[model samples]
Target: MDITCDFNTLPKNGHYKPLLEKEELKTQLLLNIRSCLSYLFPNGTFHGNEYRIGNLQGSKGKSLRVELTGNKAGLWNDFATGEGGDIIDLWAAAHRKDVKAEFHEVMASIGEWLGYYRQHKVNEAESTISWDYLDENGEAIVKVYRYDTALGKRYLPFDVKKSSYTAPEVRPLYNIPGIIKADKVIIVEGEKCAESLIKQGITATTAMSGANAPIDKTDWSPLKGKHIIIWPDNDEPGKQYAEKVAKKLIDLGVISLATVKIPQDKPIAWDAADCIQEGTNPLEFITNRKSPYHNNNSSNKLKKIDTSIWTNTAPERKWIIKDWLPVGSVTAVYGDGGVGKSLLAQQLMTAAAIGKSWLGIDIEQIKTYGVFCEDDEEELWRRQCTINAFYQLDMQSPAFLDNICLSSRVGENNLLMVFDNKGIGQLTPYFQELLADIELFQPKLVILDTAADLFGGNENDRSHVRQFIQNCCGHIAKTIKGAVLLCAHPSDSGIIRKTGTGGSTAWNNSVRSRWYLSKPDRADASDIDRVLCRKKSNYSASEQNQISFYWQNGAFVECNAHFNSERIVRNNYNKKLDLERGRRHDVILELIASEAYKGKVYTTAQFAKYFEGKLGLGSERSIRERISHLATIGHIKFFKRSPEHELSNTRSKYGYLCVEDMELKISEDQYVFIKPSCYLSATNGVLMPVENPNVWVTHNFIINDNFKLAE
Candidate 1:
């Protein structure tokens, strides 16, 4: 807050007494009295016409109430402290100063805060001319002071009650008393023009700040039922001002409205002031050129479409990410908590900025802007570190910093659209600032992380959600000629249905593209595995569009990495099958060894039949195949034994035996063996050479040995 004022230009003596007595200035202060209270009590909340706060300490409570509207606009009272005052007195009290003791300093400080510069010299050419704004009682409300300097003419408002020079937040119309009495009123661009017309016995009024008046903040209710004629200066800005005022007046339900168009032949910016100076009656001139205004919505004609244009081939559609997010449209990325939506969005923005692929998906390389409302600067720094590592990029490199712009609005008021008292959605001032930044940056992609924070309306309301997406986000996308990716959390039902939508169906319907990131739902899926599905797409096929990613190196990598190779897949399957076979082999060998020890050995066919119902091991044929393979590898040995009899007559049958219980020999040409220093053991009846018993051999090896195998 820099004060652009020359303090030396002010009178040394206490000549400020007269300045404080200007009643018109008091009215201006009262008009914007709400803002004044808010400034003094930053923690306060507005309840209808009053701003409520805890106490003078600015705590969060409703003990102090400051009137914001009507005749009591500047009045304030503290119920607990039993203290009260007008807006000026409140300002002084907030600063811990007595109004009378430190009047000059307080007034100067207040003026500076309200965008006023206190420079008044006695020079005739640089003299300040002010016109008082009067209320319906003919009492002064505020005064607009105009100073003609060498550079240009500058105006500063003087608030009488505050004893300072500052404009009101909501300015009153000049000559309100005159407007209340007149049935037909003339609206001019500046107070000087209105005063010029008023001198000629004409009913005229103007909003403060001339052509740049805050049309939304100005009180226009005074002319609600009056017939109004807008007298615009002969210039482009003035014409636009006239159109804006006409629209507002129509919305205000005025009786009738018209515009007095200045002749093109007249010099630029010629107005009622010029007419008055030229000795011409401004009203007479305006009366000759005025025309009734019609609302644009009143047209009933339907626009005809030309099908002939369809003969030409349409241009190819543009995309920020192919088949996922189209250019100049809104895309929503929804996910459950901790699904890495924000991280994914950040990586996408970074990849787009640096002309790299994001999770194996090709992205358009362009300037990008990111608004991460949930993460603060420190958190973003940590995330960027990991993302940089994944991309093998230097964070400070020009390739990254030059093309990427990021903002963290954690713990900040990030609402872009808010519903007014009338339930109509209006873009907030902060939103305008964002648009301004986007216009300057001209980014090709904008990522607003998490919709719950930026959207200020009800999420369940379809209209509010639709308006927010199409108006706020869509407008930004259109302005930048790119894409706006809004990140959001999925609703409970959306999560259950795997649609990744939240609140109203409009969240899915309104966006041109919708993507969902969720943990893989398959039984064998890893915890780190995630699947990004295109739930909806308007310009591209989405039914089979999905990408699989695995969390690695602090960032998500396409599952198509080395882990997804065909060779790796085959090896993994083979390894699992081998483990299952080993377990079954151990079961068979232990059964055989136990049966032989009990002198009740069974034949291979009997063993196979016995295992048929014992294990979930497939069909009996499959079990025979496994048994034959094990025997072929010499893991099982067979012996002819005296078989049993059910009725005392028996025949000898071949019985199964564990190889560990039999002496074995192997030909040198048929088998290769490790050094004898490595001990041999029958692992599941398969002799495996264990170089050190402490380290078990995972693979089987055949060996020629004359000694009995160790159990």
Candidate 2:
């Protein structure tokens, strides 16, 4: 939201002119033009080489076009209003500000969008400081630079070896050389805090990213045998960081570890820098406040639960989808490949985002995030269009886009956890970045598509699978106080058993709820019909364990028979028979019509042969029976035609014809037979077809006592 920039150090005549003229900056902006435009106009969509939207007012239309590729990238035009400019000008218009009058502010906003602070060139001596992180051989590997600007302090890591502003995945600690020779090293939150202690002849160091540094990514081997002391700032995050560092150090086999707890009366965020600024002795301060940390895992003590607290009222359970996904837990939906699992998951998140129904099940509407490893951005975009149509929602609405966040990692390293050299599962930097993003967005539901791509460990290893789910995915779910719906592919046995689970049973046991999406098992079922079976549910009833759906409009829609177990069981046999008969009728009618159109006719036997093993219509005998039944019902007719070779004295052949193409007359004496279940009207003595012919009904009228049908 802050759009102002510091132009005090620049020439008054052309503030931010330098930034605008920088070719490198322009190139970077163009490289990420799609993301920039998305941030500026959340309602816009990328179409081909251009991003389209209504106008700068963020409306939903294609009148405004912003080039997303080639030399004309970042250029845009609004055809409806006859207005156009570069990306910066578009940003100004989006914010309803004058470009020329607010150039500095515009540059600042752009800089913020690009993930940086916009400050005009300043005197290096007055506004910046640099600290070099040396390797074991005392050579500079990376340098951490700090800049004091009008906005706030900014830190950037520069890779000395690569000569680039980008930092390495695993960065070295600050003052590594200073801590290598010393047996006792003091760790602080920031470089300034470390330097404050170092000035007092103490061996002090810190990680590159302060309290937010990745503990697993940072090298702590240099202090493997040294006595470590962590001086945390007077804040909760700082304390947590210190605890994390201490645990990592203990794992590294450190000689000892301790934490320096600030006094209760100390101001918030007080650190060693402030301590030294107050003229306090740094060494004395550490010695006085240090509390030794102990790894108490060796003790066999267990804490007992207090039952006295049970007298109080219990908290009610919450759910993302009632009885499907409980809050603050990990739920899994597994299926075979190409079973529309991804599309189903996407629709669920979209429903939550737009407050719509998914498969006729209402969901808790909230912010949602999706990490799709198999799908690309274009594929997701195409899917989104169909989903929008199904939900009758505008994809370009700000509320829709803001509530949903999506990422496509098709060909990227999407591993959230990987085995290190020691064969221990460790979180990758990418996972850390994901956690940061989720924390920032605070989404209530996170969907990770297809575990085949994201899970890096051995699927057969029960320990690895459990750890990945509970420790990694479960942590994320707990952090957001919501549920994580993970998509997975079933194994060979899993498919055979129709359980929608694979690998170790741990995969099924680890998640709180595991549902399997698969096609219907019935031989006469439609190909588009899918069944989501609840194989494991810790929080739901067993009666309604499955839901049937039919694929429609690129998403799944609930079938009419969903959750009707009693009715389904009662009419199972009749339903299958009726469905098979209907299928056979369709096949026979289609073949007859096509052959008639081609000036060719086939007998009932020939049609039966053609229908063999087709549409699962059963054997030749069953097919013939179906044809005979259709003829009996007046849906088909038998026709006699002479052969082409009249000289041979061949007898006339009979072939089937669609009844609609023929005209016939029937006398009043002809009787039209009806099903036995039909009821006779009491008022007019007219027979009426039963609504459900398969279900027998008791009628009061008795036309004849001898007219009886078997139940």
Candidate 3:
């Protein structure tokens, strides 16, 4: 049976010591398994490592699911619940208790049970020895001992019986008095070596967890200012542990330190105890083999600045999509549904599949790959046909078709299995196979159609989001030396802040570039006009802020990039402005204000009658929309007169008001306009409402400089 290395591999020559011998720990911890069969599973049977405790709770009456397998090592595996670990881990899972909370109690119980069993075995027939660890005042702190059994060797406390096995929480030096008074101390790997060295009038000690324990786990202050010698085991782990311990000692302000490498031909774990038994003079060897400590590991040294390598000008960066996607980096393209995110990606892919310019940027027909989790192969193929028809090229020709590969139905495929739901990500074998297939293609740019479909985790969770990026997309991009464009949707995108994309900041922060695509309102243009706003760019010196495209010639063309749709609306409105319409709107508002000033209420029809033949709009739909637009701005208010009518009854008459005139109680509804603040010029040269008949407080906050608010 093989034993796990607790700290590092043990050394020879009586120079190294550790807490428990691996053989001993294995006998006590692994071989002598605790039998709780009758208690946990009534009328159940136990045979060797396989204990058939019937089926689990919900899975009762099925195959014997509640079976434990002592996996030869000091651990058990649960095939039913997919859990495996030490005895304590099994105990926690079996009883559905918090593992962390039950750790201390579990350890204590295991220790006690093992002690009892070891005592029983020893009483039958065994040989053992016990030693007492004393404090500085000569009081006994702990009793350490070892015993041999049929399984092998075991170690435990002397007072093991009905009382719980009390292990010291704060491990003191084996010989506290000798260690405190001695100016020069030798630190070994375990207690046995310390005890052996002490018997030879040498002050020596070892940490509680021996070489396995981290530096923070020990109270290293006791060794301060003492000249120390660390003698490690003659193995790989021992040498590494020696280096670590030396570093910790140096960090803890050791006055001086050195190490001794003992040459040995014995097998691993043959330590100081074996050396003494073999009659080797370890004290002489320690003196002869001592050498100054050298922390040769580069990781142990503080990071130093390297100013020798300098550049006078910025190095040129390779581009996948001229100011947007860069090679060997990550970029995100996000938008609301049907704003041409997929279509735009298809167009770009088509450009890369053939040697063509995209958005005026030329490409050399590099390899292109697309993974659309939301779309199936048929839909993706249809999109391919669209791309071919739009470009008027036989893209299905062997050359271009061979260069581009499109994968769909990804959610159905086993790809999502790679990115686990938990934050701790691990790539699966299936995923590696997929990556291998992608490697065969060697695509320069990979497009993840939608993040939500590709990532099988809570997008809102920062850990999960970062895990998906770092362990999935980021890993692929870095591994393949290519660019990755992740597609996502915004939360009420056009109306909400571009940063509010329904996830943690890591979604945006982790990517190097991001973009937003939105359709322009039909009132200002046609339904096919889309504005691609560059939301973020880290690599570009000058960002392509907004790229507008029309769905003309069957594809996205950058003939006229719309910088600001709201600004265009304003300019068009100004060019078509008529004094009659402005005067009529003013008169309607003034009339409402005049009536409200006299505490009199007016209706929409009454206001429309006054503006009849005085404005271009002829129907009530146009007239009401004007009033709603006015009310949408802070200029007017439309509501029901009282909450009593609204709260007590659904059937109630709605009212209107000129806000500055009187305290007209009302509630806002669809009748109220929802316009974003944009200004326009009136004959009076004061800023007036642009009256966008179709504006929401969306991407339209730019105010006109020539127009001031109505005082």
Q: Report, for every candidate in turn, its global Cα lDDT versus the true structure.
A: 0.71, 0.71, 0.58
lDDT of 3 by residue, 51-147 (tens): 5543433233323433344334335444565656654455455566665765434444444455543333223355566666677777776666655
- Best-to-worst order by TM-score is 1, 2, 3
Worst lDDT run of 10 residues, candidate 3, spans 293-302
lDDT of 3: 0.58
Candidate 2 lDDT over residue span 439-493, tens digit each: 8998999999978887889886656788789867887898889999999998754
Best TM-score among the predictions, by candidate number: 1
Superposed by TM-score, candidate 2 places the C-alpha of residue 63 at a distance from the truth, in angstroms, of 66
lDDT of 1 by residue, 250-316 (tens): 5664545667666667899998899789987765565432422222211111234568768568888
Candidate 1 deviates by what RMSD? 25.7
Q: Which consecutive 10 residues in model 1 have the weakest lDDT in total?
A: 668-677
lDDT of model 3 at position 372? 79
Query: What TM-score against the true fold does each predicted structure earn?
Result: 0.47, 0.46, 0.41
